[model samples]
Target chain A: MPPATVPDATHWRDVQLHVVTGKGGTGKSTVAAALALALASTGRSVLLCEVEGRQGIARMFDVDPLPYEERQIAKGLPATPGATAPDGSPRGPAGTVHALHIDAESALLDYLAMYYRLGRAGRALDKFGVIEFATTIAPGVRDVLLTGKVFEAAKPGRRGKGARQYDAVVLDAPPTGRITQFLNVSDELAGLAKVGPIKSQADLMMTLFRSSRTAVHFVTVLEEMPVQETADGIADLRRTGLPVGGVVVNLTRPDELDAEDLAQVIAGTADPAALAGDLAAAGLEGSPDDLGALAEHLLAQGRDHAERRALEDSQRALVAGYDVPTYELPRLAGGVDLGGLYELAAHLRRQGMA
Target chain B: MTVSSTDPGSAAARSATHRRSSHRVGPLAGTEGPAPYLDLDALLDDRGTGIVVCCGSGGVGKTTTAAALAMRAAERGRKVVVLTIDPARRLAQSMGIEELDNTPRPVTGLDTSAGGSLDAMMLDMKSTFDEVVESQASPEKARAILENPFYVALSSSFAGTQEYMAMEKLGQIHRQAEADGTYDLIVVDTPPSRSALDFLDAPERLSSFLDGRFIKLLLAPAKGPARVMSMGFGLITNALTKVLGAQVLTDLQTFVAAFDTVFGGFQQRAQQTYSLLQDSRTAFVVVAAPERDALREAAYFVERLADDRMPLAGLVVNRAHPHPPVELSAEEALAAAQRLERRRDDAGLHDPELTEGLLRLHADHVRITEREAALRARFAATHPEVPTAVVPALASDVHDLDGLRRVGELLAPG
Candidate 1:
């Protein structure tokens, strides 16, 4: 089966909260940021949030470390020439991208102040390490706070506020290994606080998390461990009844060789003498042995490339088994800069991820 | 051999005496001002080295590294037990272990002719915590603590519990190994934490929390008179009780009071393991991929190890794109490829086209090697004292004993 099966329309147009997760070093944060840009590009302000305190968004956007407050980071690509948004809506002007670095402690303080009107008392609690305890040592409370903040932003309506602040919220969640535990705040707190504000908050978040409005997207490169983790993470999420979104294949390499050349290289049948003749015709400066050795070197590289291609093919086959709408982002020759990020975002938008 | 080979004053003579020694150590040996090369076999052979901790950011092959090192050491005649926190299923199966309980099962198919043995185990975090509680507390108290809602949460699903439990299991294994001489070398693969330093920080964080004033404050109500508590204390408890609800507060208080008897032992064991890591017998090997972020994390780990005064063995930059010796540079290869591409417009179907593709592939290879070299050079410049081993990227993942042996050879050549 092909790696990425394009859908008829955008798969996640109705998804308000996009929880991006993957194995470490799989570039999930980059994909999350790009996804946020894609969603926001249609003239809808989107909030990109990271809960791990990595400040990955700030680094990708080349800005200062983000304060706890959500602030404007970048402007998404303008609407494509004649293209419409995923929902068949008219494309508007370029939208804004705002980022927030969510830490458990700050979220806890915010929760206390907002829920209980304990602003001064919360500061005192911080002094006595109650805030730290609740945020860190308390089971599931840390996750509750982090997810609580995202829930507040993504929930349809606030108590006093009339409309939603952002069109969508993109969360750079934990790595795949712990993503299930991280998001299953309800189960995690079920044993700890059978009846409390924390328990009720977790239940509320889980309802939103399991609802159609939320989607947990798996970001992976075409490699063994990350792909395996993605598969496992998806299954875990499914078992937990969480909303599963599309799969994003990130940092993909370009095809450098065609089928025939790749076949010859993999079979070790590419003629070195012929390659030497071509090199001689192109250059004008080497003996038979020099060109022969160079050809052999290039052939070894070709063989390695062919082998890697085979490996990637197997991995793609594995990803195909996932049975989800998959997207591929090309690997930037130079590392991901702001321009590269925008390029990725444009790819996502063109692929109907928005 | 370990100390003398790495000495800068005699490095020239050592290189002269042992052909390919410098190249085997690091390719950019002389040009890069002679960064220390990590001698893996030497480290494995050293009787003084009791533990080898492989740590770095995730997906950089820490599990494979630890497994390979453990297997190499065991085959080279050191009784070794590898404690892998999380290994891919294929790798675990390759070691002939299907189940991943806490017990270290004997790894089959080892050479073992040199009087060595290998055992492997996966850490079960909850089981390890239960073992600690079972060992430290009586039946009734242990049952109470285990069934308590707070204890259940902390042991089973807490963020830092895995890290803390890994340390606990390591301490347990090391103590047993010392008592019975069951193993001479213990290779540990840390958890895939968000930050690699989380393991180092987890024990302290968890212990400090267990020993913190807030926990003591929670225990205060049961231990002392109610009137002795300050009004401020009353206010905090009232707020906590209000927010947490009365039942959760009571559950937490009960758990803490019961757990207080065992937390002292937990802190002591954590301290012992912390010192064990800092001990001279232990060696910290920081692993990383040749990518920018992984290398940057390696640098941070190296610095953190230094600041903490942990004994750092060296760095293993895994999956490095080191190409064979080629005189042509990337620029020359690219130029040749461009010329071939232009000529291909007029030429036949097969030879020129194939040659152009080959040249472009060569050019990409050269560029990648150069980029990796630059990154390694930067790491070496900042951490010149660190002995490094660069392992080339394999075409496929290692999933068998033979594959692991190949990796071992690549890691430490004969």
Candidate 2:
């Protein structure tokens, strides 16, 4: 096994952009939200953005659907005891999380208006279906515009007034299968627009994507396919010379049985009579047959649990082979509401992911 | 956000547990249920059902479901072909089609006692597109369109290309099946898109982009028949050139002009496939996990299918956490576990640690089952007309043929 480069207090402290990608249904949006909250400190304005126009962040925070504009969605979680400054003082108050549902057409309009000041011409382009073609049908302009918006948010400075400068930007990018091509915009645009503003914009985003200030984290569940995708995704990111970040193992199940009990359950040596006697001794009202049935039920569930635990262990071992700092967020019993989001943020901060 | 108490002793949780246990509402609780069952065997046995399209959100086991259905159907004496858009490496190997070169190869090691056969293939999107181009255009014209920079970009990495190519391949396979009688059943696994319905919409999206007035404007100069419309078209072209660079515009115009001749055929084929999907012979099986987002996507797909007047077969809720077939309430289990803990603390005799752990695990299992049941019930309430088949959560991932067969058994159990 490779020696994993574990994240420390200073590891991601200086990152200006955090890109979170994962297999679908791995709770990638939730992890990105938690990471944004983790990175948001006092006086730090973290921008959480979704480029797929899914309005996932808005739904996650239980707010109205966010427009293309960046709006403050929620306040960050209060700094945990683990989140201390260099001198061991408690971190300041929680910061703010602003979210943007960045759609390609609006971003393209914004880009053209900003770069060429072609207000009427841009509207004409829309009338001609050029905006639709560019954003949806064109090869790579949609990604270019999407990442360009994120780049604008994460860039260091601004020249105009009212331009919001974010301390950190968290993007809920596309799925792992398309993530490398999504982020490596330069290569995506190389064949089509080699000398255009879009090409340069893609190149600029590529620079930030490959820099130390950026980290692309992956969220995955402890399943075979998701882990396999994460492994392949990380390798793809590394091969493209992009900055790879830590892995956040989301929705992890807690072990209910210890090793001996699990082994006995798996081996079918669990004493059902003892279990029934224990149930009867615990003051449960049941007949002998009922007790036997209940004991069998519990043993069946235990065996399933044991098997799942074995699978999860193997998957975790596979994740460990990636040699990156890995953090785990437990599966919330109830669904992830806002409070649960804060709980996950606290877990990330405790793991020094901020 | 209010921090709702997750404590087992909380009044809300206890009451909820009582409600669930009293009603026995779960995937496996067949004694008290009106939840509809999707008869996979009947669907597979039907000779009129020529195509089955499996679609849903990603990570919801759509590919596995499609593969299992094909395997089961083929082993039951039907000639089956499964066109999986993207499958895991082990799953492809299990089907004996490790080479995903976009051809349907026969899967060996099937039971064949029923005189059944299974052929599996993975979609290679680029090759599929190339085949379409080669079939549509003359050799030199196809070479021009294929080697064009814009065509390369559109075919290789365009947003809707995979979905489009999947549709194209489906159409090709269906035509060949009809002509040669090679296979009677084709099970299609849709591409894993942000929206599960992208495959259904991809053919239209691509054809519209190709047939739109914008493409006409770009091809006006190349076709040399737009002398009357040049003034307005030149302004748009100049704007496009200023924005996308002159060389980029020229390449696009050239590609569009070359592709224009072939796109009419493409559009007609896409139309035929769309009609094929809406035909009575095609059945749409919406697959989802018992999670909220996946169910929500399933709901959207169900509504969309209804809107499009497509034949809705049923829903397959995969990886459902079904509680053990016992009348144990979570509240009662927790109370018993707490009583055991207290007795152990007081006397230290009868060390009921294992019993306590079992009770807690059972309580946890009950809670999970209740939550999943609620999610499924919510979906059912919205779309009660749709039949559903809930597959229990397997202890391990399905990789090999045996595992897939286990899933098939669970899917349509007697």
Best by DockQ: 2
Question: B288-394, model 2: which lDDT tens digit per residue?
Answer: 99888899999999999999888999999898776456777777888898888888764533437767878888887767766777777778767766767878778
Clashing residue pairs in candidate 1, if any?
A: none
Q: In model 1 chain A, where is the ten-residue run with the lowest total lDDT?
A: A1-10
* Cα distance off (Å), candidate 1, residue B123: 0.9
Candidate 1, B237-355: lDDT as tens digits: 78887788888888888999999998888888889999999999999999999887898889999999999999999999888766446567656766787887887766543477778
Please list the residue runs of candidate 2 whose C-alpha ends up more than 4 Å from where it truly belongs after superposition: A1-6, A41-43, A80-83, A86-89, A281-283, B1-34, B225-228, B342-351
CA shift at B44, candidate 2, in angstroms?
0.8
